[model samples]
Target chain A: MDNSDFKGKNILIVGLGLMGCSFADAFRDLYPQKIYGFDINKEITNYAQQKGLIDEGLTKINSAILGECDFVMICLYLDDAVQFICKNMDGFKKGCIITDIVGVKRKIVSSVQEVLRDDIDYIPGHPMAGKERQGFGYADKKIFKGKNYILTPTKFNKSDNVDYLEKIIKAIGFENVVYTDPEKHDEKIAFTSQLCHVIASSMVDINVDDDISNYEGGSFQDMTRIAMINSKMWSELFIANKDKLVNVLDNFLTSIESFKMLIEKEDPKLIDKLDIIKKSRESL
Target chain B: MDNSDFKGKNILIVGLGLMGCSFADAFRDLYPQKIYGFDINKEITNYAQQKGLIDEGLTKINSAILGECDFVMICLYLDDAVQFICKNMDGFKKGCIITDIVGVKRKIVSSVQEVLRDDIDYIPGHPMAGKERQGFGYADKKIFKGKNYILTPTKFNKSDNVDYLEKIIKAIGFENVVYTDPEKHDEKIAFTSQLCHVIASSMVDINVDDDISNYEGGSFQDMTRIAMINSKMWSELFIANKDKLVNVLDNFLTSIESFKMLIEKEDPKLIDKLDIIKKSRESL
Candidate 1:
């Protein structure tokens, strides 16, 4: 499918938070079509409609209105997304392509596939773009520019639907569209995203009492910039991807322990290790 | 002990590297006088002189020429700084105010005091500013603007000398001049600066093979920006402040382990810990 095919097709976004509103804005900019949205918070849905982010905003899940959407994008927490889909599976239109923007993939993909109709195309996605802040007030259409968007499709997904979704993702301004399986997606994301948040949060958690403003340089600020995270959302993500995240966390702890031992022993090889790390970072 | 008193006074800087040339450039901009420098690398010394960062550059240390300087700033690796001061102790003019720009404080302060004359005021200092790149070629006078300059003075120093050092630090465009004891300075810096570098290096060290450039977001880039560090310099610093740094590192590991347990058990209290971390980061 192309832009002309999506011109008159109705699209539904099942959350009006930052990511959801951002997607709505980007899609509206590309296709110039009506974009409908649903959010549990009436204020957010109303605000998004008022801001012209969505053509129609529903505070409650209306099955009849939802049944008409050609595409449905779920932008809720992992468990909440699974429950929302299971509760409203019959509401979606027949042959409507379903997708999501959740951080984790394995659990969400498995649960979503178990309950979704066989006729529906449920392709899980993750957009590698976010800020330390949250809310629709901070949403921007340019968030997808030059960012990676990953699509994890199982054997159950239709190839035509996957191609249609990829075209829409590219049209929405994502620079790279990576294709992978759910297991590999979750494993890679555990190291690249979730582990970074855990490190930043833990670094900030230990220094609550110290007045670091006087001594903090760019390095400290950069390392902890993501420490101001959305607690509830991240807690859900951490629990959802626990096994992979725990493995990465163990590797990080081992690296840190090695560093500690080198310092304790005043080992001369510490310089060699640091050189290797510097070379590694330079490659990135 | 003020700006006027510093006019026409000779200043000698040891180690014509990034931090050394930055100090020279900032000081020359504030008070244009004879700024002499010494470096083991003749190319760096010559480049600094040609760029007007220093008035005179010496590839080899000359005791006769160095003895006439009114002020001296040693900006070398921690061990090198200590050795340079010890070897050139007799070369400084009588009652000349001496200082250093090394990162760690306790050992530098102790060693400088043990070898210096009673009349020379050897106050240890740390400027909370740097870049990932090294060498005098990347040095800038504006690096110190709106940054913190800390002075760790002991009872062995004169009060008038401390006031003089503070005046020079302010004149260099530093936004804040913090006065702290050596022990407290090391403790705070272990949490704020050194530990941050350790974490960044370790983070990059583990993911050497991953092609992160295609998928990295702002948080990953921010956290690993300082991973491109000077190995020899940082290794000495990490060892010099090992005890305090080890304490902070242990606390950080404990926090990470607590987060792991929360995820492993799917504990609801993870939200509380994340909230506390968010609040702490906001204060920073």
Candidate 2:
């Protein structure tokens, strides 16, 4: 089974949400042996199955279904994902490759590293792609197109398993696969993902008038587009990476304060500061 | 000249940069008598003329050019727009309706109101549309489509002239025309346009890595897209609207700080706060 193509693999999708169904639908096209989708709610898994996203749907932990899967994709939220995996640790096939689509890395990797069966390899990953919408009905395979997939591979993760996963990731339309450690992934993501959500969410929170979007050109709309967030999911992400997020937030506050001071004092250096920021952004 | 159609009107497009060229291009299709474009740089005016964005380009303010214009659209930066309008107040034709596309309204309307000729009516307006790219060459007439055009009409502005301006504004593809006083316009705009720019610019300024964009998903890109700032122009705008911008910035800082503290303390209320923010943004 070393470096096996997805065509010969039996896969399990642990949550029938947007990310789960998307991966299930993509894998269906690649002719996987069978897909067993698990969701605590039977309705979601049934809907996914009816949509041809998975070959079968399971409401309970069927040891046979879990034992047959060569690849298991856990698409649950942070704490729930850890709980699901740790509880079902003994059900997975020997040397089964288990990966997750959790947002944060440090907490997920550390928690999973403690209870995993040594025979099975666990790879922690984040697919940096999603719409503002959620749920199985909103799932689209194209969401993965032209997106980055970050892998924080534990030392126990087999190189062959990582390569096999990368093959499946690329086949599903991911444009880039970035390899890094759990700590580095969380730090960069804290800056790129969590910090942006914080700023966008705060921008929305400050609107004094409900109709203020009427005055917006394009800037306000673009900045706050992501503010149509799933609140529970995001708060969990924020608290999970609070240390890194707070650090980045402080840096952002400091940076904006300088602009405020420059404006407050009517300083001539404001132009230079704005010019430097513009040049830096243009490079990006 | 009472509520005249664009066909019989001669329009002047001042400061032939992106906004000026776009307006001129839109006016050409409406079959205005002639468009006299004014710019400080002779080469830019020549480029605009060669591109057919204007009928003729004037480097200096010609009394004949100013005198014949039934409508003068000042597309200059705030300070430059003020200087040009006040300096040439005497040259405008009687009952000529003048308007501006400056970001801030109070300053432009008040300055022009003090020295404006009684014979001619100045209707101050702000077109809530633009691209991050600058210059006439990048100007597109479609930028006005489905956008808001804000008007801050003064007491001296005649009813017929406001109607005349509204017709032209609608003809140029503006979807909505929002009417408010100068103070209200400044305040709302400070929250919508100026505050977004400040946040976007600061987001860029806080980047710890030049290669940070590589790690970004769509959120970071959307938030910082406007950070490609025109340093000198933006600095001028910030200083001009310092009081209003600072007030809103403080509110925004407070809002984000609440988020930071909520995350720092690992409070359960963070989810509720985020949920409220998400609902508020959805109402937009």
Candidate 3:
């Protein structure tokens, strides 16, 4: 339990799709004692083991397998993660530290923390990384490089456990570890992640012939690349964080409407407005 | 005049800005008789000569320089280009072919064609290439690689001159050449280029703290990269093409509003909508 290098630590990865398999691939480099993967899909489970991403694979969750792991990553959809953790609270080893890679924080963390065990620590996590295409077939450890791993630590989480999680994340190719409260994490993510996908999807849905790309420069390609989306997962995240996202959308509308008027009137002030935006964009 | 190789042609690059300097850099590889650059900024004109981007430099246009050139590329602002062409119409050598690199076609082409010299062929063009930064210092010929060059040929344009342009553009690294009428060019370019810029600028103008980028994945970065705006240039293009751009913006608002409602109601229909968007996006 005191091993900070993750040596001799048994790790469990639930829902072995992109995030789970990718995590398993990274943990192999850390030399964990065992990396066990569980998924409802037998094909993916066998595939992960065959690819050497996992040392063992489970098609179903069993207490014996779960009780041996020192850490776990619940890489399921938000509501499913809540259900999985709540239903199997007794299965995890004592003093085990678990995390999830779902994008939204408030809903999943609130639901799971409502009925979590005192003997184990669950630190809410969001790795700010993904691809437009989903599933294990597209999984690669390279996606995690230069990305951030956000940890929203609540009162129930121990300081040592949070530090250990950060250490493992850095080892797994994340460039930085960010700390925030659950509410603030959701708010920021709604703007940076969810709002961007929403805009890209809308741009594509405007229904211009795709041949219109013939006239495009790199900017249009960059702006709309994420319109190729994971529909089910993103739809769920958008709804769960609807309040913050819609508010951000409204602020965006106000800014664009002003631009509409400036263009309509051929206003000289638009130069100033765009200059301000340029400076703001550079600040990022 | 019939040589598609540009072997004996003197090419004049007007304005000596990003596009003009970059064009000069590309034309260097074609071994034109000479590349002459004209700019109000003496520093830039001298820099182009020093860098060997232009074989010769002119601080101001003249009948001596204009009369000898077999081809010209007007890289000035749309309004300035109209003025320059009108004032110098009589100076261009007979049968000299001229073109422009303006983003908006209808306004500039209409203004120039009204007073254009019949002896010289003037073709309206748009190179679907640029960078977020402007000016001669940032100019690089590599931007033209794997990009498109669009020519909106009018009845006034001679087919032979347009053919020569296609040859030159291909030699200078344009991957494709698209032909459209000036009006259709304006309409389609409004959506593909101008509207995308408007969206990126509005996203930046939303005024969130720059630190919000800490939570961003690449999607947000991609969506907002063009918000590092050439304020004066883009605001002018937006206003010049306002009617068409405003109409396109309305269509986008309608599409995004539907997304907002779907998110608000937590509608299952959102999954269907996003799937459609994903397919549409893939077409590009």
> How do the residues A18-107 of candidate 2 rate in per-residue lDDT, one tens digit apiece?
889988878887778898899999999889888888889998989977888989999999999999999999999998999999899899
lDDT (tens digit, per residue) of candidate 3 on B145-227:
99988999889888888888899998889999999988888898888888889998888787566677678777778778888
TM-score of predicted chain B versus true chain B for each candidate:
0.96, 0.97, 0.97
Pairs of colliding residues, candidate 3: none
Estimate how well candidate 3 is docked, as a DockQ score.
0.83
State the C-alpha lDDT per candidate.
0.86, 0.88, 0.88
**Candidate 2 structure lDDT:** 0.88
Model 1, A1-284: lDDT tens digits are 54424777889998888899999888886664568899989899889999989989898888888888889999898888899889999888998888998888899888887787988888899898877789999999899888899998889889888888888888888888888888888788788888889998988888855568888776777778888889999999889889999999999999999999999999999999999888888878
Off-target runs (Cα >4 Å) in candidate 1 are: A208-210, B4-6
Report the error of model 3 at residue A135, Å.
1.1
DockQ of each: 0.75, 0.82, 0.83
Considering only N, C-alpha and C atoms within 3 Å, which residue pairs clash in candidate 1?
Answer: none
- Give the lowest summed-lDDT range of ten residues in model 1 chain A: A1-10
Share of native C-alpha contacts between chains A and B (below 8 angstroms) recovered by candidate 1 = 0.83
Please give the ranking of all candidate structures by TM-score, highest first, separated by commas. Answer: 3, 2, 1
| Residues A1-284, model 3: lDDT tens digits | 43446688889999988888888888889889899999999999999999999988998898998999999989999888888999999889999999999899999988988888999999999999878778998888889999988999999999989988888888788998899988999899888888889888988888567587688777677888898988988998999999999999888877778888888999999999899889888878
